[model samples]
Target: MPLSAARTALGSATAVALLLALVTAWASGTARRLKSGVLPIPAITFPPGPAAATSSATDFQEPYFPFLEGEVATASVSVGDTSHGFVVNAAQVTQDARLGILPTQLARGLDYGTEALVAMLEHAAAQLYGATKTRLWLGNVGQRGGGDIDFSVSHNSGRDADIAFCYTNWKGEPVDPPSLVPLNGQGQAPKHGLRLDAGRTWIVVKALLVYPRAQVQYLFIAGGLKTQLLAHARDQGESPALIQRAAATLRTPVGSASHNDHMHLRIHCGERDVLGGCTHTGAVHPWSKLYEGAKRLRTASVAATLSHGEAEQRRRALQRLVLLGGSEHRRPMAACLDDPASGVRTAAARAIAVLGGRDDIKPLSARFENEREVEVKIAIIQAIGTLGGAGAGRFLAEAVGQPDREADRLLRALDTVTILRGPALLSVLPDTAAALSRAIRTARLLDAAAGAEPHALDRLGALLADRLLDSDPIDPSRLVQLAAIEAASDSRRLELVPALVGLLQDRDPTVRAQVGRALRMITNFSYGVSWASASPGTRTKGLQRWRAAWRRSRGAPRDAWLITGFKAGGYQVPRLGQKQTWELVRAIAGADHFSVNAQAVLVRLLDHRPPSAQWSKNEACQYWLRWIRARRQRYDLDKPPVETSNACYRPAP
Candidate 1:
């Protein structure tokens, strides 16, 4: 079954069951807060510590938006057996009698993964003679909820697993208490009273490589241990091809702590997970076909499946055709653009976009006019954009000029513009200034309609920067410029800062105010001047101050560029233009590393409840601060505030 279909069915049934349960509880007068799509909450009953001190269901229910820029896990974990994959019990790994717990308090033991991979590794280890009969000790995979595991950075999802290296005593007997003995030059642990179980370790490594369900992307280990394992495999007469794969998959990861103690196995996102919105970073590979359900289907078979299979099968077939990419499949793939099912049509449109030519534009445009589904239309527009020619460019320009078009369609038009303006394509069609304005407006609409994507922000910045640099005297409207500035600010891209700095001296006061806001968003430095009240000389001084600050911290070795201390003569930010200014201030004040003074100011703003059409900003900030303070009081007070959700707070910096 397609996991997407199962998810929908299960989620619906669960929602109904939960509602019935709530109704029963209400009849008994036992229900308190009847939250939407969630069971009634009793007080959190987990043991009182950082491990158990997670955000409550009620807390997440409240409106607060968290800015998450890193390895983000969206939506809830799928409802099913966690062992098969969606495990919610953080205590499961900790309490498992089979696994030995490390003494490190940082290890919360909440890792989850496919049971198939686990079984394969265990069975492989058991096959080795004189191997330790003890259960494998495991490390963090992910929290039960599948967000960032506090102990490790990349274990946000369930695809990562860490297994302890097998170690033996001097007598060549497996030890009860596991130990990490560094391998010597001769692949033996000489110093400690332990030795590396090379034969047994090789078994586990080979199992990972051969697992049907799991495609190991990287088996991170120490350089010496990797060398030791490869040598052992070669010595054992392992096939050169298999040994090559082992070497390719096993290597030291960049910017990670040395993994001499345990092997960190990172798996690619399963095909099922991809259908459920799991995004895989980096390149796609042939192994992807295994999970995509196309490993056995050749081009003819896939093309046949695309024509006669179920909608899902057709979708998968289209995807496989894309991966199998060849000129022979283009005609069949293009036929899929008109597939009855939207999913199939979407896949077909995407494939066609990659393979189609100028000759295909007319049919795509005709489909665009007739298509009812928003996603399919977007896909068609993208296809048209990718197949850019004079005709395709004209079609996109015409769409852009449709003032009465739906916001979603306008957003697609903006996307089409971005593609058309790429390296291979000519200039943005119709007019550059109009295109820039459309992009800014379209971005704002998309943010409200579907939550802004990162690419939209990039397009907005690029268009505005181009106009600022070009000889075109047609400056964008005040609203357009402000929208561009805000989009750039939200993106947190420092490269956009250089382009925005020039706008600080623009004649429009709103532009100057927004420019200042964008700069402050990128770099927390505020040159002691006000956009609304500062004279030309004062603005220049402020600009100069910001330039100097940017230079000093331009290439600073940090995740984000933020000032630690306010310079001696730094400008104290005055009250600027309404909602945008406070939004910026609220973001800074609620940031993970915002100074104590800034936080205190945020408290004041929340308490005072500033006057604005968007009153939720004040309420949202207050709710966030209240949650943070309560959480801090219960747990570690010094830990920085993190984005729990995007409802009431800013995204990660």
Candidate 2:
């Protein structure tokens, strides 16, 4: 099957899996049990700690020592990135009638979080209800294992939770919202005839700030609501320190939803969790100094352990250093490349890849030469590639040409070369090309014996093709040609149009089909030939028609093909107005094949970095569309605006 069809099938399978999970939950009466309060309220628990005297003595000796202890007692382990991580031993937030907090129907079985996060939410909600008798409506926290959750990007880890904002009627009476309501600039849900209850919202924010268990990283909300809440906090004579923390914590995230409906709360990774591979992205607020200081101390301690511990202990320590991400640990980790245990050596090499500098490359390359373990050798090659420069690229080029290297090693080296593309690799293109051809052939024979799909090998070939397309031309091998065709289609490389047209008459049916797909992606035109089952005559006519379309497209501007089928009727024009150009770009940004190129072009045109690559394509597209529509008056198609946010635009000097 084609790549596009494979993605669709995978999406369908995921949907079916989710549906089955929901059905099982319903059949087991999990939702009904939660609604009826039969499940007991869950309490936060901590592992046993050292005696008070020991803790106090440690604190007196080192001021930062207490922070990790505090974290251990309060925070649960959140392992990995928030968008792609999972929680280890997750804590589930249960409904509490006395506290007037309940998960919405959609969040019933989904309200799992870290112990600190659950405690923080309960504390804030209980404080609010004790004063105002208003209930806090909770949205999705995360799933049981904390992987992907529906309708959210950051809640995959237990650190993120969504809560509905306090709302009120025109008479200033508190309103219990059935669900989230998106508010306008004036703090009013215009369609719903409700206004934001800034005073009550400020109370929740204040309670969250005062909660000592976890430090809040971000309280993402709409800017308009943030203004009203801050103003209300001042009017209520809240402490200056409290107001300052709230001011710094509340944010309006760029390149994402305005977050006018509810606040998305993310907590910092606890110091103890950091040792377990938990990572925190974004800023480290002043209030989080305790945790930050503890992390620095822990890094040194872990490095010490790496030198003296048993093999398993050293491996864990090495892994922790990688997660901590300090360049200073690179030398200590590199020293372990000579460790007796292969696992320790593997972890050390991989750690250096992530945290090492250019100077660390020599140690990795030296280790690769003497390493007898295949796994350790592969890890070193990967590390060299990741720390790419002229030196690293040259090392990879040499590794690729080694005749005694196994097929797996050759393929790994080729993959590295693809990422390290520059003059170093280009200078040896023929050798690198021949190595790639050999690797693919060997991989195919191996896969044929195992009766497995050649997906990984094919993907590697395509990536190499994309990297080598602009280099010195070489006589194309069969697999190289197919890979080039696939890369051109995926990247929307319009400059390859003439070459792709020439491949229409290639002897291989697979080549012809791929060429047809590439032409369709480029021109947005189809001759309706089923390349798989069509007769020879029908296939010839389809190829001929595609060639004709390619000829006609030559008269138009290079990018006109993007807007070819639209009703706007500027197909043959040389230059489109700003509105028409952006409109076409927006349409293509949502296309399957050209979306990546669309993102790159849009980034250049706007003179801003694209949104996080971690975001779903749909999420990124939506952000760009909203950004352009809001600032359409400020920018022209050919020139970027003078003013741009430092957060989203080019960095300041």
Candidate 3:
């Protein structure tokens, strides 16, 4: 055989051997689960727990872990955009494809991504279940410009894609003019237009697993329905290996409603895309390294040609380097500052803006003066803003204060400096208070730039609150204090609240409303009216009530909500190991924040399992609370410690 043919033959054999090994592994797991009396389907459908309420059937179940954090922290590929990544668009809008697109998603340019896996799955359904027998409907992928979508917490990134399950008629014929019709495990729809196509659905799941280039991170499905799919696969004589691999990807997600009718497929990030701030929370599959290696090689090839490549090649390389952010790549990117093509130069500036830090500020500022291209100049300013330190701040302050500066560029400089929040203003101007007052006077700049930095809020509140007291008539910067108070940490609030209560008497309705909201968030007190709609009378009463509470607490800072229910009414619980236990529980429950440590504790407490199979936060909380209370009470003052209390202890349902 020729070399190409021999390579293909080897690939095929490897795939087959891998499949068989997977089947044997899966079969062995199934036998263990069966002997142990673990069920194929969880009994309690509401929240996953061990030994579910009804079913005792056994099948291969994969270990579970949540996706990696970075959902909100990462910047979108586009400036002022929210989504963190980008997807290459696949299919055009086709009227005949049973796909439904949300109008809002379409309007925003979010309804696109790498559609290869989707295209393959669609093809597999048609081939396996007969032509025109099923239609794969799609929901939102990332929004256009890949930022935060209004309805999802994690879809701010491009890796996640929501596709509705395949629907068919009772006779296994495609629903005429295919549309999504959610069905239960009996393959029966709540309303009678269509039924679930189990075989076709299995084919879709199998295709995702076997698709050479596709690395599906998680396939969110309802637990009861997943049980049906696995059974269907087994009954259809699917090779044990293929079924096992497919089973590994399917899961019933916790912290959300059961994904009964649809599947949320989150693929891993592209190996080549350089995500500076983006993070992957899911388990890293071994195959992902292959994609990453290939992508790195491609990017390296492009970066290598930056000095000597064609204009288009250099521009492409510049864009790639921007996504693949690194200090090491900055030198080549800096060289692009002098590129003959204006577009390439602009791209180089933007890339450098993100990658360059304090050291690059001086060169960037010098370039800003001589660079004649308006776009490239703007890019340089942006780079300087991102490279923020005293030097960058001084440059920005000078630019904004320049008498000849254009209004728009000056405003842009003002906003950038506010975001950078270094000694920039102070280094050039008189003091910290003076710098903050200048930024706050810019009108709406304070609100626009607030909350990006937690510490910024602290400085704004402290400086501006004092400034407010000094001004006789009212200070315009008072709004800055109000906005800052809303975003301030509990520690900042401790220092600012006593002073802020006086603002309730301010004549400005906006200031009063903002202050009210901040007070409400910081404390549970709301004086018989919503601040958003509060009247002058309401504000007076609310302020009076807050004052009384402040005095009652003897001027101590109000407590954070996370500690409200603890024994001493603070986060610091008194008892042997109890403080740590409360923190662990809070972390596990993720009441207000995400913590890997908390998740790990929850996993261990739940017996080395990820939250699935009828596991709800309420159930987990109740179980832990009961265990804690029981252990706490286990010892009377005379009794010894409760040795019987294990981490996996559960209360009776």
Candidate 4:
């Protein structure tokens, strides 16, 4: 036989042998494909509990642990802008003919790490930006373990996922049992990581990293996670120069023998599955070294892991390092203006706004002019909408006047606008009018617009006036709209009278009759002013006054509605129109001239207002709001000790 022919025969036999082994290994396994799923970290035997109550548990479900019975496994992928969700049912996974699969990479199995990353990112985005940034895939790509030679079998049970960077050959396609061609001898799988454009991949990576739950794994760094560590070193712990140096090294062409394109991510698994000979006992790997290398490269390496505090602390620290002006990544705060990490950018924008400053204007405007992430851009627009004063207002008006004024940024700008009665509002009134004429019931947008311009009643005056005039009466749905409009009314000084006065003569019997209730909105405004404009310092004064009030008034917020005399909007607003309830509360509470009234009113707003009515001030509303805000404060304090009762409310470390 010719030498070439003999060599081909041997190679074919070898490939066949390996394929047969994979088949034999799982010939009786579940027929369905597994995708997205979450795995929680098991309680560890520590010095009682977490090193710090907030410290995240490093381990997850043990393989011996079982998953909930009959729970379906599914996954999906992000193919550009859309997130496609899929359930693990009869999926026609193409074995050959170029199946690009990014399967689970967890070594032990999908565990808290994997699940946490996704959730953390989502949480961060929502916390930072108020929306979820996670992409939905056919199902979540996953498996039981990591460090496995066969690329397709998702063996690791916890925190591991695999990706095919490139498609070289196919396996299970010609039939049920698929096979991957060996990249080389010695059972070294061929480099088949995902193939993606570079900068975009970084965006995805950033999004995952920002999630509080995520912990990323880099498969082929020369020094394990040296490269990874180096990148975040300056921000995470290393110095700037060291990080830059590491960045330079990563930019260097890493020898092709290693996979560089696609990443191997490990996630949390709901329970452990010990099917394969996979185990992560004492095998946990951290990206510590890689981060260090990058820090050394950037000359910014230091000692430490992220320390927990309250949300505010983390926010401020991240801001200083990522969002604020202090860190080298000054643009970090600005990235969400057009970021790919779903919600990171949004959260960044919101945080920047709350940490209010004149310094952010230029960067914010730049993002407005150049941003592309629809939601991120909108956030930027919204944050800067009312923040820019007259100059920002003019620019916003002009920018908003263009076609497609309701684009993401435009809509977001409309959402957070504060100067509703002024020139900026007047400029956008045309669009607002058009929105209302079409009966577009976007409660948030409408409420924001109304609140932004107190004279919303003036611009929308005709609509209210007409509704009042309708003899047939506006339906319940329309009443909801009216309520939202009324809620937005600032009722400043005297101008509010005409708008309400006009509604009094409305033709609609409902509008005419509801005038009394609507009149209460004016009083609601008084409550808002007395409460909304107060200072934190004035709280003490209010408390003092409250202490001096008749003891019976202690329960006033809960029962004040006894004073109302007629038809109700079904939506309960604690003191919607009880002017005396508001005024007397402020007086009795002896609140500071500037703030006690405000605190009194806030106490009234216990629960969130009804979706449409915008009249949310009440005890339940106030309590819940205070609770969330306090929890946020707890998050800022390195995950403070929750007095057991609040355990459920504590955020992830």
Question: What's each prediction's TM-score?
Answer: 0.41, 0.56, 0.46, 0.22
Write down the lDDT that model 1 would get. 0.47
Give the 10-residue window scoring lowest on summed lDDT in candidate 2: 36-45
- lDDT tens string, model 1, 505-623? 77766567656765665565566467856999998888887778778777863233443332221323333222222333445334322332233344444453221111123334544
Model number with the top TM-score:
2
- Answer with 2 or 3, whichever has the higher TM-score: 2
- lDDT sort, best first: 2, 1, 3, 4
* Residue-by-residue lDDT tens digits, candidate 2, 413-445: 232222224332222122223222322222222
Better by lDDT, candidate 3 or 1:
1
In Å, residue 167's CA in model 2 sits off its true spot by: 3.7
What CA root-mean-square deviation does each model show from the true structure? 19.2, 16.1, 21.0, 26.1
Model 2 backbone overlap count: 0
Clashing pairs counted in every model? 17, 0, 21, 168
Model 3 lDDT per residue over 1-653, tens place:
23233222221112112212222223233211111101101000001111111112231111111111222222222111122222222223332444455444444444534444345445544454454444555666654223234455445335666666766666768553234346676657857667766766777777677766557767899877788889999998989987776677788886465677678877665442223223345556554433455545655655686875467556655654544434477888887787888667766765665456678777776766766554455456545544555575466444422222332332332222222233321121212232222222111111111111111222223333232222322232332233233332212233334555666666655455555544544443445455545777876787787788677763543433223323322223233243355444543343212222333333444443422111233335444544455555542222212321332233322
For residues 12-125, what per-residue lDDT tens digits would candidate 4 score against the true structure?
A: 112112211212222322122211110000000001111111223342211111112232233211100001000111112222222223233222222222333335433323
